[model samples]
Target chain A: MPKGKDTALMSWKEVPFGCYILESGNSVKFKTGDWRSFRPVLDKEKCIKCGQCYIMCPDMSYNQDEEGYYIVDLTYCKGCGICASVCPKGAITMVVEEV
Target chain B: MLKELAKFKGFSAKNLPKEEPFAPGHRACQGCGEVLALRLALKALGMNVIAVSATGCMEIISSPFPYTSWRVPWIHIAFENAAAVASGVEAALKVLKRKGRFPKNRRVDVVVFAGDGGTGDIGLQALSGALERGHDFVYICLDNEAYMNTGVQRSGCTPYGAMTTTSPPGKKSFGQMTWKKNVPAIAAAHGIPYVATATPAFFLDLMNKVKKAALVNGPAYVHVYAPCPTGWGSKGEDSIRLAKLAVETRIFPLYEVIEGKYYITRKITKPKPVEEYLKLQRRFRHLTEEHIREIQQRVDAEYERLLRLAECL
Candidate 1:
């Protein structure tokens, strides 16, 4: 976890189980058997690089590399469908990854 | 000694769990009713539960990046797939339980939450599929009339003669020309184990219905009338009171459909005029006297039908 950063990507298992904590806390710990990650697969053939998926993602999970093509960070992606919904062309799909 | 023993055995508010599964700090609008409904639903479901929310106001506001309002295991799927996701979760849990993957002594309940646009419109098909499959889960529709998350667009659940982005009232036409879809009746037609219509104004009754739905082994549906202050153009603090007036005016009746039987939970002995409910919100400000009369007649007819169903029960 980075210092002074309120939100950091961590496994769900690191958080204490059955404890209710508000989202305002700077640090988060997950519980064992609770961590799940969602990976975004972008088809290069269908990629128009419109940046709609990158812009619409609420989690800011996607980023543009040196080539200007968008790539998603699976470690932090919550798998909400703002990207796919806003994508004019069918370009994005959320795939659940094994923890 | 006997009095002290009885006191210990009796129910006390303090004995109830104080954990809030829906924590504060989400970006729900100042007076968003869906947020209140989520809070109350969490209070009913407790900590040992997972919530599947559809794409709507609650999902967007509460789940922006590193912030999430939910204290429970929450999943946000597509706009019209909350019930389907909940069904998958329940099925997975069942398989895990059978395979000893989950603790045999403990069980987890699944709840699906969706807004009116997602539930009454886009998600109805998926919801019906889940109910028909007899998935052991609770599906709650926090109906705020229109698609408030999408800039107050009119949805099928919007009431007649109400202004919306899509159903704007004009010189030649009334707002939302069509009447609101009868979603509770549609759920009742599924012949599910339990179905009920509730509102935030009646907190105890709403919680009771949620508890009953949770205990049922098969599919259960709870439609909650959540007043939207921003969409309805009303005072934010008046959300709960307006919900109460909706029931009093007989516009949105409080009732339950259990085991193919209809039970009217809150019956207005002397129903107030429909104007009393409409006059509170600016969305219905364009309704003329004739339109108000028409709306009242429709409300009376619906109330009569509900009364008939109760009688048959």
Candidate 2:
């Protein structure tokens, strides 16, 4: 389903008043990853693919690859270090950004 | 560092599912406790839910102009009628499903997220009405204990002896003279299916309570201890620490009432003094040692009463 700008393109009268989007799952337009001061780097060799990062991330930044290994989607990751803190095997490391 | 290590049990993270209905960005302050609670609550509720938010901090921050942070179907209505709006939505969904207008497989959970002022003071009537009518929805009170969105005014849930903008400490008076309202007990009195108190510091306990509330057949109430750094005069980073201390000091115990039976979910085995919780925030700085002792005694008495209720039940 079309969302964001397309929904905004629709007639104002047609859509419900008060900033109501016509469809769900439309938060992609807002990039919040810039809010991060630290970025998480995964040590794939030691990851064990427990899917801990995928499950525990508050931002839902982790996705499973075709081989079922979890990868961080940095587009929306605020780098809260929750995934790192929750990783039992210590496979994830948080790197401070130079900026 | 050891304290942080002991606070989190890593294994519990494995149980959480990766679905972000409440996205980051928009306009929450750094380390916002209410936003954290909303994130976790939405995580537990998943994508198949409709959230009705009252006109407060969450609503203002999430819905501005043509932008929204909610990835799910969300509504921002008046401050006092989120429950009413949710009840309408649930009723519409029910009738639509029964009349075959909606797909048979479609199951949408209706949830209301309101602040302490909205839930405990302004919206109390609508909430009570909905709960009494037994709407199949969850009413979550993000109890930050004051009117945070409107310049940090005192509310019904604001604890006794805390300084707010309106309840400022003066030469002749202390701040917020009355005790915090026992909202969970009020919800339980309606004989609802579930009523619980939770905090974002205890992720497992909070998520579990939210999940249970979402699945219950009747009205379910989950009061979350959402500490507001801006209102409480604490550092933004101390949000989680203050929340943990609130629980640890027995000021906000984790408990649930299922059909009038009380169950203390998390016990403070080695409880700290209320001052440990109060000293961190400037809101309580004006309080003297005598005032602190009074608050401590009140907390002890309330906790003991809760324990007795749990034991008797």
Candidate 3:
């Protein structure tokens, strides 16, 4: 996840044989929240919990709570405003740098 | 083994599948509909499959060094040989099962994900050969309308009057003078078992078609109209809306061809004008009124032709 690390510093022995990543879905270790210029804020009162935002988020940032309300994890949300635009009830709104 | 949806049922809003085969944290562009389509696709097919990716946006974003977004087994092949690699994978699986080296009952689905440039242009020959040879694999073409991975350039699947780096609209010429090639028709011509056109806007329909493709025995090709907000010069939030308009305006008709029989998936009874679809993307912003009319007529005619084919069934 370190952006400044030099690739040349790594030894050839550290590379995976044939470059096959043994850990599946290992990309989750890298957080991409900093890339977003905007962040989505949910209005809990207006949410119908239709799961629309949860399914539609390209970043897979939304997770449903036990109460059936959807919460966006800023760790991966790209602030694309898709969730706000797709929300039928206008529960989610995009704001600048809320995170 | 591939679990076929015995009944032709679609997932409702409340009961959608919760599993995510494509993980987050990879660097796909914000609001990238292509990756969203890929996510929905792998979700529909489940994790019991092997995915072969061509050198495209999906390949680059999903796998970077020691990290991979794919939870299932994936292979990255060349720009023009995803189908070939998939064919080899399917053949190897068959041979291994027959030799008792693997579980005889295990039937892992082989699926290929290729971009527009890879599918309709570079990989067309390889795809044709694999389909003709009757390989048990599903080839999904994620068409973003141009060579988006290598920067926006004209592709065989790029629509007429659309601006790209290579097909720039100027005083001398209009963007993409030629009409979009009918790749799905070409696939249908191969006389394969399954062929479909879907968009991520209709998530249920897209997922159901993918499931059905895996259910079918022979070669299956699903052409997905994925919106590239970054390349198309459109608002990221408009990706889904644009795809929906593409269907409603009759610009990209949704349908399926099963063993030479055609069936229109989402019929648009009250269609909107083609301009409604074109005006959203800056790629088609340079079109004059006459050009708009030309595109409208062509889209309507193409839809009518498809309707006639569906009617024959």
* Best model number under DockQ: 3
- Give a tens-digit lDDT track for model 3, residues B1-313: 1234356566677668889999999899988999999999998999899999999999999988778899999989899999999999999999999899999887789999999999999999999999999999999999999999999999999999999999998999889999999999999999998999999988888998998998889899999999999899999988888988999999889999988989898999999999898899999999999999999899889998999988976
Cα interface RMSD of each candidate: 12.1, 3.5, 0.8
Q: Which segments of candidate 2 are over 4 A away from where they belong?
A: A1-25, A32-99, B1-12
Clashing pairs in 2: none
> Candidate 1 — which residues are off by over 4 angstroms?
A1-99, B1-16
**TM-score for chain A of every candidate model?**
0.57, 0.78, 0.84
TM-score of each: 0.74, 0.82, 0.95
Q: Model 3's CAPRI class?
A: medium
lDDT of 1 by residue, B1-313 (tens): 1121223332122343445676544555544567767777777779988889999998887776555667788888998888989999999998898999899779688998899889889999999999999999999999999999979999989999999989888888889999999898899899997899988766667777787788777899999999888899986546766888999999999998878988899989999898988998999999999999999999999999999999987
The segments of candidate 3 whose C-alpha lies over 4 angstroms from its true place after superposition are A1-13, B1-8
Q: In what order do the candidates fall by lDDT, top score first?
A: 3, 2, 1
Mind listing the fnat for each candidate? 0.01, 0.20, 0.78
Candidate 2 TM-score, true structure as reference: 0.82
Q: Rank the candidates by DockQ, best first.
A: 3, 2, 1
lDDT of each: 0.77, 0.84, 0.91
The candidate that wins on TM-score is 3
